[model samples]
Target: MNLKFIKRNIFPLVKIISTVLITSAIGLESWNIYAFLTNRNVPSSLNPIFWIERFAMTSHFIESIIAAFYAHSGKKMPIQYATYTFFVGTIGLLELFDQEND
Candidate 1:
């Protein structure tokens, strides 16, 4: 119930949850792409999921590029930062910011 404890714990927990959700989504989208490639029958209702995944991937890729640029300018390892950004989204950016600040 302490505010400090909640502040310290809740944000990391949220980040972990978001990372898991994103990873699961990526897995599902990968499966969908595989199905499409293999000519498997996909239900009409699920067709939009592919497009949604595409958009999500595009956005994440762009974010990763931005993170790479930021990392380079910060004299950090760009690929490492970018890979984190690619998989975990803006929480990685937040971590980069915190490290740079330190």
Candidate 2:
């Protein structure tokens, strides 16, 4: 593939994918956090079937929150930050950092 083609395609593709992933992450994390705070989430129910998902979500939430703080404090973005921000799913830290960088 040509550099020109890649340059045109990849950035836009990345933006689109990142936007979608981040949005979903925010939604899911928020939902899980709410459910968790109220003790109504599946994890709280102690269903074996939900354990993996709960564990994954919990970890994701933890990572994302840390990433958010890191991004907010003007630190470099780690690959994990992308994962976290994507999971955090809000529109704040990413936009803040993007504007700060620009």
Candidates in order: C-alpha RMSD to true structure? 3.1, 8.0
Residue 69: error of model 1 in Å?
Answer: 1.0
Q: Candidate 1: lDDT over CA atoms?
A: 0.78
Candidate 1 clashing pairs?
A: none
lDDT of 1 at 80: 88
lDDT of 2 by residue, 50-87 (tens): 45545645665665676656664565465556464545
lDDT of 1 by residue, 51-76 (tens): 78677778878988989999966678
Native RMSD of candidate 2 (Å): 8.0
Computed on alpha carbons, the lDDT of every model, listed in order, comes to 0.78, 0.57
